[model samples]
Target: EVTGDERYKDYWRFLHDGGMRPYIQRILDHSNATRGYRIDRLEALAADGIPAILETRTYPKIGAWEQAHEGKPWYTRSGRLEFYRDEPEFRDSGENIVVHREPIDSTFYEPNVIVADPRHPLLRPRRPEDYGADPRDVGGDARQARHVVLTVDQMLSSRHPLAEDGYRHVFHTPKYRHGAHTTAVDTDIVAIWFGPFGDIYREDPRIPFINEMYLDINPLDARELGIEDGDYVYIDADPHDRPFRGWRDNPEWYRVARLMARARYYPGTPRGITRMWHNMYGATWGSVRGSRENPTGLAKSPTTNYQSLFRTGSHQSCTRGWLKPTWMTDTLTVKGLMGQKITRGFVPDVHCPTGAPRESLVRISHAENGGFGGERLWRPARLGVRPTYESERLQKFIAGRFVRRG
Candidate 1:
């Protein structure tokens, strides 16, 4: 019996390593040989070096080309003659580039996402090592790089099952929304000074991927909060004790959350942030569920239910995440429905400062709905603490800064 083979395994590796250089060179040679004068237009992008390929002017001009290809049958009104047939110029132009229906796959190899093993030549740096670098394996830093900076789009809809959620099954729409105003390379939004790519908004750098999480609150969580699109809600997270949770805590956590929560309201004019579909992010295993459809698991859809975790101090609503203070004798506890004893823990969403308290569980109060009429009217509130902005943001900025610098 014959076993199936992985046809495209080496296909990508070979193309990236060997094909890219030749392909670019060929394009350059062909463009030079076939001058704009030969084609009679100034659309050639070869005037500048390879870097020019990324310029806006070099972007392909697809305007009239589309209309011409889609132009209706070329017939004259009076004689009903076909211009395309009668005119040699028209015919030549039309026959030169035929537009045919065909399927198109836009997937292309991205250097950052492709994992590079020891054998991959591209992973190797130049010899003699620049600037006192260690003479390590050719796979240098590539071996250490594990996480990929995924855009909200690819992170949400990729065929990877981890990319989806049960909410997609129930609502037929993604439950989470990640917001990104600009590319990671040039986010002008202010960040803290924990490191280089500091937190953009406040002085704190504990917020992780603030740009990413902001989208969740502004648009996605906005709907759940009963706030209309473009509307804002204030958050009031009470500082929790340090003992029940971890001792690490940052006092600025609450204030940072407030600032970030406010910033989400205005995502700027030009770089208006786009809300990413929810359930597309977070720890791979942390928020997911289990079932036959997804035996490994399905991400717990970030929903209105999770929104409850952020409600703190009176008049405060935490749609994004939560904040907890680090100190003893300040803890709160509550029991779960099944008497499951759950302890308070810091929200893993963002970074926290040293001596900051991790968030723990808290009681939730709700009025009896009459389903089991005669029950206590207003019961104790539910409890749980999520990561505050400072803690989360600091962790992300530090992690990213270290990775880029190292």
Candidate 2:
């Protein structure tokens, strides 16, 4: 959330990789300090020289040679274990240097589960039963309690077929908008951004800053068409640029794309810059052969670099819907407002009639008897409708069997 550079770099690597700018670098440094503090506290307790049940471990500086090494060890030991031997602090790491098992706590800590932060709104106790302490006894604002909660689009659903239902489908470079990389969907509920720009969510600050992939309709466009906040509209664009092949060549992708456009408006939009996210807009293709010709608007990437322009895929397709309604006027009023070209499209991620999860709408597909003909291996079914136990077993098997294989 601090700056655009860190976020984009993370996106590019398909991994969270990048250096932060000065201001953001400071925030990261603060986080490092907090981690250091925790290590220090645990070590401080252990420094008393008396052995306790609680185990404390600290990593020391590593030599240049050790830092450059990569790949898993042949013996199956993790690099973390291997790092300890050469770390500078290991010399005085005390006699008890072996790694010990972590203690199990029935109530607070649970493996494979994100423990409630007690403060995060999503995880915080809503009633007295949550904390096991009577709410009546614990007065004061409940909102102030640091509630640990998962924001709307942060967690992925176990029901999603894409998470693990590997029936085998092929993806090619040309089929994707970019070479060697395509739009990666985090089927989990996490909000997306243009690579790693920043999070836009108020509840969870971790929301990624996605680019506006669709043709954004500013307030002026909305006003001209009398479109309200949830009103539906078509995006007028040539499908030539939206090329899909191989696995993306399916009828479901087109149908899904059409349904994706009905998104809520960021109320009071500006005159110049379009504020639409990827799926926030209506159908990708619309035909208005009447006297009123739809405008041809230009979309720009955050950095003016053409390479960074909004590509076909990416979180912009799904995460765009999470942008809460904002005034259009605020964005368009920027300088060079009039000189820029403008296009309009309905926002994606609008409510699906079937009430499926929002991400389901953005999966690629085609219409019946359209350009794509046969059934594809990965057809995304609507949400809240997938199998439960079987799906879980499948996911566990896939994660266990295939994840580490590569």
Candidate 3:
């Protein structure tokens, strides 16, 4: 739509109409493949004959695979593995040499904080006096290594908006076991084992068959906050760009800008870290409180909304996207297969425009009404009904696959 090219509307139809073959042929034409070895048609991609790109019948490995078999050079400027980078962007960023750098916002330092390790031969002090140490002190080694610390000035900076607010826990969203990335976890079968509450409303038609998002907190952290297992809690993060900010005053939205989730005490989790599945659904027009004309109270959807199964809010409520400067570089560089080098601008995920969402710090507290006390509970008539043959079979399958008989 932005390009106003109608042919680009239906990508599948465009490909079937021979719009993509030209691009494929262009790559093949530029490849080091001999004219006779290159496939003339796109159908040859699935043909029995081996394609020019495939060096062997076995799986192809990246790096040196082509260099060892064919005489093609590596994709780097020097055509060999090198530790030092001479790019101006690298020099400006102080990342000319590969080094360990802490996370942007997750760490105490501001975004892109660089620190030198005292253990490194080049960074070690020649004498104890060089680092303001007592020259009279005798030690086995010079302990002049500097560590990253949260300073009063850094806390007051706008970049560390939540630093002074005492939001200590690091919030992270990881993939769900039952889902493929963000997909499939919402289904009834997958939901049975996905969340703290599991699929308790599976048989209720009024309620969707899905699990509510929950926060996995270490037992020590939960105890300190007076949060017990299965207790409803509100997770609040940096308010600069928090979720549902516009609906803060809306009476219909409960605890706007804060994520409501059940707190699960997990001893395996670290004290300062919290985990939530990344597959939970987000709020939609149908899930939002109130009608198009007037809005009031939660779960007052005019239409059927499965996202309401998410209960209060999504995991994203405590997180925001962070863009890296190195990822935004427009420098033309050589990339692609060894034989098919393409000099182009930054390619997302490959080089540029990467979104980092795990840098958020959050604080969790018990909700005003703990547990599901004030919420409208779904107790369908089928709850006490006798199980049918189909239900029995499904129960048996679930037991065999997920639950232990003992």
- Every model's Cα RMSD, please? 29.1, 24.8, 11.1
In terms of lDDT, which candidate is strongest?
A: 3
Per-residue lDDT of 207 in model 1: 25
Error of 1 at 263 (Å): 4.9
lDDT of 1 by residue, 1-406 (tens): 1435556554455575755544444445455332223221223534543224322222464433423565632212332222222222212212212222110111121212222232432233222243344433212133122223234444344431211221110001123233342223133342222112223452222222332232223333333444332222332222232111221454433332331211132223222112222221232111221111233222222442111111111111112122212211112122222223433322232223233222211111121121112221101101111112134446666568545633
Model 2, which residues run further than 4 Å from truth?
Answer: 1-216, 234-238, 243-249, 258-268, 277-406
Q: Where in model 3 is the C-alpha error above 4 Å? A: 1-74, 108-111, 117-161, 184-186, 202-209, 244-257, 290-309, 332-339, 368-406
Per-model C-alpha lDDT, please?
Answer: 0.26, 0.27, 0.55
Candidate 3 lDDT by residue in tens digits, 1-406: 7999877766556476766765566566665432334445536665856444443423543556767677667566766656776565554444555665445545433433444443443332223354576644321122112123223454335243355677788888877664675463546576556754654543322222355567888867877887666666788776545664555556355443357776766777887888887776655555554323222233335566434444456677766665554555666365743535665457656676556365467778886433343332212212321122124546667568666767
lDDT of 3: 0.55
Better lDDT candidate (1, 3): 3
Model 2's TM-score against the true structure: 0.20
TM-score per candidate, chains pooled = 0.22, 0.20, 0.60
Candidate 1's displacement at residue 206, Å, is 4.4
